[model samples]
Target: MKILKYIKTNVLIYFLIGMFLNSGLSLIKPLLLERLLVIQEDQLTLDMVLSFILYGFCLHLIFYSTMLLANFVSNNLQRHLQLRLKNQLFRKLFLEDAFIDDEKVSIVTQEMELLYDQFFLPLDLIIGKSFILFTTIVFILWQNLWLGLFFVAFSLLRPLPQWLMNSRLNNSGAAFSKNQKNFHLSVGDFFRGADTFYFYGVAREKMSMLEKYNEDYENARWRNEWTNNIVFFFNGPIEFFSQVLPLALGLVMQERGAELTTAGLIAMYIATMNINGPLQSIMYSVSDIQRSGVVRERIFSILEDSSVEYSYHTVDNVSELVLENVSKNIGERILFQNLSLNLSQPSKVLIKGASGTGKSTLLRIIAGKIRPDTGRLYVRTSKGEEFSQFQGNIAYISQHPFFTHGTIRDNLTFGQEFSDKQLLYYLDQVGLTGEIPSILDYHLINNGENISGGQRLRLELVRCLLREKDIVLADEITAALDRENAKRVRQLLSSLPIILVEVAHHIDSEMHYDQMINLKDYR
Candidate 1:
């Protein structure tokens, strides 16, 4: 059922049709050989050979058409499955009460891509090969029962070597994938702190680690290849036996004076050889199927594990957010505890905390990014009614802002339907109007790579202002900026009417908050 979950009905139908055509075509080869051998003693006419050629061509056409259809169906199914899984993942992320862990998300994304490749292709091959194998066996048994038995016995031996190879490959593959992930993580860490590396003059040392990882990856690839080749080598002898056994037995029968036509012997030999084709196909697909099983298990585990749930209570509108007896824990370590706070609209509060005092977690709880383990959050609307939901009223800006590779205007507007004048006004407000040559014509690289960190942060602030949320939860938004830019950003935020809850390490002069709630006081 787990594997079948990925198989859509239309895909199954397409596979069956393809299998039927392939089996029918495979039967033709053996039948044609039998007919040609039967007529070998007679005067082989041009018309007879032409008829045989036409029959073979028709079977080939059927095989080709079915193969194409199977490919089409498999591709479509793969596309749909990828989209469906992505959509589900997006929904899960959106509905969760906290930001998704980036590391976990990365792992899930890679596993999903691998699962899509492994499941659909192998399933198609397995379905088609099974049909061919079944039809070949049945036809051979009907023609000569003893030869069919021999084919079955020899075919049973094929799976052993394949099974051993598949086991070894899968184990090695898992190890390789893990090592590869570690390598990527290490490389990411190096590049993300290029400044540190340059300042410390440790670039060469870091590069050496990358080279070692590459060598390990290459070694793993060769190991997998060598293991598979050994299986193929073992299979070659089994395949040879498949063809030779029928011929040898047939000759013995003929020598013993049992009537065995040349046509019959040839047909039996072809049919025996046909068994290996399907068996080999199955072995190839089984490798992918095993890999897919690992991916499917990973995907299903994410889908099944419960995250934070949305509150059932609804509000007409929310004006104030309140957390009473709130606490949070990651595993057994309490990140925060007994933190009670209330934030009202059109007010500003500064949340000051040490590096690891959970200021960001507190902000997340208020912004509905996280649910406190032992407390209730009440949201009161401007009209004096309360609800348990946070929606359409809060904007959260983290320390590092995300920007799509695009123009300054696009980053500010965030793809929202904004007019030219509105976009320009917001950009100007954030002091980015002069940075770009033209407000309407500015282009930015992805993640704002072409821009400085201060510029990106300013753009993010502008984007948040444009959203016009009632409350803004900003976590170290100005940390990357120089003093001048930080001062400007502080002034701009102070002027906004939204209730601001900011997490800051340093508070400069003349930038006063209505309430400065230090997390250290609570601790």
Candidate 2:
């Protein structure tokens, strides 16, 4: 059903045309071979042989054309579904407030790939192959009832083993997926905090953790392989019998003096060969699809979240942000309780607290990056209507600013189109242009590796200010800046009308704030 929604009518029309044509062409070889066999007995007139060859050549042309069209349709459909599923999953992650393991995202991407191969890859083939197999059997039955029964019986046997081992396959697949996710997470964490791991001398500990995941993944893989081997065991003999049994039966029928032309026997052999391939595909595809259950579950776990629905909300105004009776906890220890803040007007609020006191967490909650255990957050308009979100009016600048691999202008404007003059104005406000003359068009490596720490902060500040948001949440943004640059940033914040919530340990005595909350005492 989802596939149909994205498939274009022109593409679908081509797909259908190709499918019927493929099925029609499957009988061509058998028919031509049957005729050629008859002509050989008479030493065949030139006219008869050429006519037969011409017919086969014409059918081959149509066969290749239909095959090309079918491939084009299926390839496009696969790409469309891949992108659609990816966007839905990406949107879910972008909106999720609660913790979702990074490794799980890695697993989700892998699952999408496997799902495409197991499910979508063979989707159109199911229709085309089933039709071809059904018609082949009907044609065989028209010639001889016993031959049709033989083909059907063996085809049924091939899938029986897959059914027997399906439960084991599902269990193994799920276990492998879990272990693989853990393995990826471990490797990712090691690289992300390689310096800490080295300083702590916990390389052995991380290796031990990784080994556990590796062992579990290998064990699950072996179990899945065992289950597959069981399936192959049954399919092997069925495949052999599909080809060999027909010839054995034909010889017996001929000895028993059955009435049939030599051409009919040759057609039967060609049909037997043609029918078995499609039958084998249909049978094994059933098990392959079943094995991808873990993949489907992992991908949908992100795509089917109810929380994503409420992430985007309407607000009448962005002037005020309210947090009522907010509480947060980490495990047993309460970070904060019954915390209430009402910012009716724009102000520079400094959150002061010792390390690990949840100051950053509190700011994240305000930014809607994390949800408090208990609280009601609302944005009130001048007309008195409340909305859950403040839209794009709240800009979040983290300790380490995020920068994609693109030009400075690309990062600053993002999706919002800005004139070069307007971009330069914001750049000037953030003191970015003064440091680097050609700031806007300047390209950065991945995550702005080409720029210094202060430059990164300034570029991010400019990026946010370009939107002219009503509020800014800066979490230790000036921690990396020198006194001169930090003083410059503090003065720049004073000039802006936006509400600023900054969590910084280093503040000059001259820096003024509308409110300062020492979180250690904010009950």
Candidate 3:
């Protein structure tokens, strides 16, 4: 119903009109023939024939035109739903990142599309076809009572096999959905880390793993396809009966000297053919209904779940951030234990070691990106009112900074309401003034591709400076720069009043810091 709930009463009015037109169109031939044979007492006239022909044409005209309008309305609704769902999922993936695991990317891209196709599409079909079927059945009963009763009895039997195998079919669909997502995620990982695999001489192994995932997906696909085949196999005979028997039995009754007129028998045949498509739709729609039900359940699990809590309290007049006896263990490996530190004033700290020394991880904890396993993280205010944590108060620059798809200025300022003057000033400070050809409006295609690596770092620096947070966490900001520019960046950071935590292997030895954390000695 959540899927159907989107079709507002106003648009639903048009959709219902579409269904009504479809139902009305099914009645045209039957009524026309009945009027000629029975109502006119077999004294059919040229004027009567011509009148019916024109009237039938007009009904078809309205039907097709209303159908077009209904299609446009449904499409607009689908697009709106896609946009709204994408925005919510984007926030979940990027903002509330605590819920992110291996399947996050796959869920955001693949499952979103799945939800659209499997859930909403089937509901749309059901709305259109169900009304047509209901209306046609009513007309059938009005025209020939015995035939109508027989048709209804047979149509009910169409779902017997479907009901029996409902659980098996649903399980098959759900398993395939899971396999498809897992396969995509694995393929994405293989592509993203191709260089790493190549360096390790494990490229072949990665390919084999991808092949395994592909095989798993293929197995699920084949199983689901076979299950569908079995369902349709049962449905095939019933559909054949529904489509053919009404016309057959009506003709048989006429041969047996039934009271049915020649025109009436022809009308009944036309009526049966007209109702067949919608009847088949009603039967086949069960599978789609079940599939969508499963998909809806999956989507609801995500939207209804709020296990990841983000409590960011931006404290006023906060001069010091303290971590008391903090310890963290990632799996079996310990990253930090009893890591107590005090930052009461503007300070410069450089954290550095080998790659696995948890330098970035430590900075992440300070920035509230992760929690310490054993100890408390606190931001002690100057007024002695300590808050739970800090996320917004600290500006972070990652080793590989990322940007959303947008212009240079869009990525630089983020969502901050800043003027052109503020932007240009920060760009100037980071020495990225003439480097960007379009200046503030430079179009950054695919995460700042128009800019060089050094320019990317400078752009990040500009964004950081614009924030003006009390603490700046810079992780390998100077990694992409040459000696001269790197020195300039280091010196610029040291001169700032904000507490700076820099993690770099290529540190400027001449630059002075209030504290130094060489992870080799600290560990």
Cα deviation of 103, candidate 1, in Å = 4.8
TM-score order of candidates, best first? 2, 1, 3
lDDT of 1 by residue, 326-411 (tens): 88877876677777878776678888878888889888877776668888887788888877766567788876888777776666
Runs of candidate 2 exceeding 4 Å displacement = 1-17, 97-101, 104-109, 193-195, 198-227, 240-243, 250-259, 309-317, 505-508
Best by lDDT: 2
TM agreement with the true structure for every prediction: 0.86, 0.87, 0.81
Each model's lDDT comes to 0.73, 0.74, 0.74
Per residue, candidate 3 scores C-alpha lDDT tens digits across 258-370 of 87677766665566655666655654666655655555676666665665434555666767878788777778987667777777758887887878778888888888867
> lDDT score, residue 509, model 1?
60
lDDT of 1 at 108: 50
Of the candidates numbered 1 and 2, which has the greater TM-score value?
Answer: 2
Q: What is the lDDT of candidate 1?
A: 0.73
* Runs off by more than 4 Å, candidate 1: 89-113, 116-119, 164-170, 255-260, 291-296, 306-316, 329-336, 383-385, 478-495, 506-512
What would the TM-score be for candidate 1 when compared with the true structure? 0.86
